[model samples]
Target: MKIVEIGTGYTQIPAKIGAATEIVIENLLNGLNNNGIEHTLIDISYSNQVKNSDKFELSLTHYVNVPNWLNKIKDNGIIHIIRRIWYSIGVGLLLRKLYRNKLQTETYIHFHNQFNFFFAYLIAGRRLRKGKIRTIYTVHSPDWSNSKKIPKKLFFEKIAILKADVIISLTNIIKDRIKESVKINSCKIIVINNGVDLNKYHPIIQGDKQKQIINIGSVCKRKNQLETIVNIKEFLLKENYKFVFAGKIIDHKYFNEIVSYIHSQSLSEHVKYIGEVKPGSELNKLYNKSMLYISHSKQEALSLVVLECMAANTPVVLSENFETFVDFDSKIRNAVKIISNHNLINEINNLCNNVSYHKQYALKQMEVIQEFYTWDNIAKLMIKKLAQFKQTL
Candidate 1:
């Protein structure tokens, strides 16, 4: 079967920086290519730097150009809505021409963004019937899964769900939440976890690791980096541990709060916030050299970094709030430490003080990554599920 994968249109595919959704799309396409699956990626035009980069293969990619003036507006405001609508219309028109006389059942159109899917449905949904071309929507971030109120985004997400033939959720918890929130049939949703590139992120032999802790994500209130520092204040002050935070500063105010807290507590020497780091080699190196990787994110569908760390044979500690997000089984539970805000310091200490225990957790994490979280394995699972889904159609 042929497949057409659509990106968020806000970021280029084969992302060089910190757009997790775009990165996931890039890896999934690579997985498909490795399996010899016929597919094409439809994404926004790349920047001059990305165009010059030798890292990505653009022969199979179709670039959609949005107006340059739109970039000047603030993100997630009027510009966000306008660009999504523009991209969706472009995608719909392009698909119409591509599939003019082609057999619809032989093709699949997969989408990863709510706004794009919602608007594209308006243009393409009526023309493509249920038994014809299949539309699959993968919910990358179910931000409204736990919300009590119906925000504007949730409304669009609900519409997208109704428009899609099938929905792919990153975790069982998220699948259940989507069912309850949207009142859709559970059979329509498939659970597939995000994947890591094992070839790029693998364990390295080292004599001894220094006392370093690393957290990678956008510096924002949602990621809760400041709270992570607050929880480990004593360690930063008394111990020789260095806390390294890396990501684009999406929220300058929240970053300032982290800086002020670090300064107020005399932690300039112990803590550092290096801005966004490129993915692949740079990220994998950071994961390998650090003694431990930690995240205090308030919400996530499934963190790609968590899997990357595991593939690098690094022990991971997470906030207890992610218990639902990761949806770890008993086997996977032994691979990572999850602690509440109250027990954060104690758990970190337990992992840091015992070298054997740290090694054990790292080994277990690598085992889990090998068994289930590789990109090739995930791509095969998606193909299997799609075959089954076709039988029903």
Candidate 2:
């Protein structure tokens, strides 16, 4: 069977921008290829004209044209919504052409975004009854599971959930949220956690490690980087270790606020800012060299970086607000230090100062990840689920 994976086709399938969803897609396709699946990914290219080709070795990359004018608009809540709807329609047209060709093999159209699901329902819902194609959507973000977005978008998103043949939830939190909000039957929703590329991120031996702590994600309010910065200052002052904040400055005002606080507190010498390191040797090195990895995000669906750090055998610290770690096995959960925001500084210092505890902490976290969260295992689970779906057909 052939699979047509739907996503936002950037200029490249493995985009240099290192968006988490794109990285997950790239790895998921690699996993699928290793399992001997034939698939093609069709995505919206923001360029004015269509530039489609077989670019990626693992899966064919088909770039559908989206108006270049849309790319020029500065990102806002409205523009992002418009972009999603635009890509959804483009995907719908592409599928229509494919259907008209009277394709020979059974096809599975897997959607990564909720907006695409909306257009797919409008375009492919009829074709679904013809039995040539099956549709599935993986809800990768928490926003879809909750009715918290703009009402119009939420309406489309809910309809999309209702229309899909299968729904993949990245976390049980999402699955439960969907069951609660959309009232979808438990049988249709599958809880599959995101997996790490074990080959790229396994533990690495370093000659000399620094007393460095690293946080990787967008510099936005939701990420709560500023709060982490302010709270960690006393720990830095006492330990004289450096903290690296590496990610795009997504929210200018919030970023400026972080910078201002850094200067005002005279912590510039202790803190370093490396803007947006793409996933590669540099990022892996950062994960390897750091003594600890931390995230103070107010909420998350799941964090790929934290898993990458665990794979690198780095001790991790996360705020209590994160729901992802709560889903971890008890032993795995104990390996990570999840503290309330008020106690962050003390917890960080305690972990940093105790060398033996830190070493054991890293080892346990790595062990859990290796045993349970490899991309190969994740792909196998997906294949198993697909096999069951085929039997029903």
- Best TM-score goes to which candidate? 1
lDDT of 2: 0.76
Which ten contiguous residues of candidate 2 have the minimum total lDDT?
144-153
Candidate 2 lDDT, tens digit per residue, 59-157?
Answer: 777666777777787767777777777877878877776776566787778888777777766876676546568788887664643343334646765
Q: How close is candidate 2 to the true structure, as a TM-score?
A: 0.88
165-277 in candidate 1: lDDT tens per residue?
88999888778778777888877788888899888899877667768899999889888898788888798677789999999887889898899998998999899998888
Alpha-carbon local distance difference test for all models:
0.80, 0.76
Which one wins on lDDT? Answer: 1
Question: What C-alpha root-mean-square deviation, in Å, does candidate 1 show against the real structure?
Answer: 2.4
| Candidate 2 deviant stretches above 4 angstroms | 9-11, 46-55, 68-83, 101-106, 144-153, 324-326, 341-343, 389-393
